[model samples]
Target: MNTQEHAVGQVHRDDISSRMGMWLFLFTELMLFGGMFFLYSVYRFTNAEAFHIAAKELNTLIGCFNTAILLTSSLTMALSITALQKDKKKLSIFFQLLTIILAFGFLVNKYFEWATKFDHGIYPGSDTLLAMESGEILFFGLYYVMTGLHGLHVVIGAALIAVMTRLTAKGIINKDSFVKLESAGLYWHLVDIIWIFLFPLFYLIA
Candidate 1:
């Protein structure tokens, strides 16, 4: 076999390894959130009525709206990846920018949602929340912890995408070497998936 062919084969193997490494890291993230979801399940099972009442206080319309925004962002991320694969750099950057904008929108919605909760004194350590039933307190506590963590992820994802956009503009992440964009998309999809689980558990508690 020629030396050049062997070099290409090695590069292909390296790409596979890189992707495998990312999947492993993502698995760890899944387990981290998985444990939180388990705790939420146990508490909800034990305190059904309080959870129900507390969930009713949540703004379902806003929750659904944020879900739509995240889902659309996920689509944009996918399109960005596709554009990169097709060597459409400008289109890729456009979609990446769109995804970042949607991420900001999602955060804005979350801020207002949390603000409304705070106005009602429903925060983690607020006296009002403390006075609520054990089940309701548990619900809000987990709600804040879980969703807050997810929001942090969204922010980080947006930052990563912004960097990817810059790299694409600089020709550092072009079609020949676009694994970074793919990895960012995977992370963004994870963010959206977590919210999908969260939305129903927190807002559809009928």
Candidate 2:
């Protein structure tokens, strides 16, 4: 409850328990994404045309760029945790900052891409929604729902990183640091992994 009273794998925000809890939470997130993927399969089977058309509308190059960016950030995050474990505070903070910057870039690029789509009359609902036939409309419907949820996770992951940055800067995390940096890493990896697949599905399903 105090961010340090973890037990049985609740992720006391630090320690083995925290890592276990992080894995547990990640498993649940996996299941959630799994269900979405299932939905995607169903709809793609039903609306192959719309799905293909919508997929083409996405900017594949940009998606690939972001994928690389996230993968790099994941590397930095892992290095940060390793540095923390080795009692390398300064290096840990440096990697953490790098990871943060990369994450921000990923989100900014996403914002611009999505904004451009909206400008071109494509969004969850409204004119674009009206323009789409039933199956096409349904295609964008799933697109919005899935990507919107993933975006929410991005925001949440950024918030977590901000918190970790603060805690690390304040010297709250140590070799024995009771911070959930690893769990943070776990969540970060999950975010990256989700995007990896989503990029292909949403942008390059040819």
Candidate 3:
């Protein structure tokens, strides 16, 4: 093949390899969260009453608001990808910025909710929390660990999308070469899906 054809072939192979790598990374993330979910289920089963009580302590209103924010962010992320595919770079960047803003809103709400818990001395390993019953303590332990980990994912996903936003603005993630944006969208969606499960388990259990 000619040099030009060889270069094109290499690009295609690289794209495929990048996609496969992202998928593999996502699978590992799923496994990590899946194991945590399994442990949560077991703990919840054993401490159903305590779990219910602890769930009641969580601010459901804030939980619902964060859920809405994340759901909207996911939609915006998808729209960004769609716009990029249609060669609407400006629109794509708009959606990407909107997604990032929504993510920030979600984190802000989560911060306040967690702050309320801390104000009440309800955080994991606190003297107040440790003074509670075994079941209640277990419930709060899982709550802090799981929700905190999910929040970290949110931060990382938002940062990734922000980078994609800049790249898209620079025309690097245009229609012909937007796989990176797609991968970022996939990761963001995974973050949303994980929160969907977490919301019911931690906030709606009551």
Candidate maximizing lDDT = 1
TM-score of 1: 0.94
RMSD of 3: 3.2
Candidate 1 weakest ten by summed lDDT: 1-10
The sequence of per-residue lDDT tens digits that candidate 1 reaches over residues 57-116 is: 999999999999999999999999999999999999999999999999999999999999
User: Runs in model 1 with CA error above 4 Å?
Assistant: 1-13
Candidate 3's residue-wise lDDT over 39-129, tens digit each?
Answer: 9999889989989887889998999999999999999999999999999999999999999999999999989998999999998779999
Candidates' C-alpha lDDT: 0.94, 0.84, 0.92
Better model by lDDT, 1 or 2?
1
- Candidate 1: give the clashing pairs: none
**Residue 54 lDDT, candidate 1, scale 0-100:** 92
C-alpha displacement of 39 in model 2, angstroms? 1.3
| TM-scores, each model vs. reference | 0.94, 0.88, 0.93
TM-score of 3: 0.93
lDDT of 2 by residue, 85-160 (tens): 8989889999988998998998898888889888988887678668777767777777778888888898788789
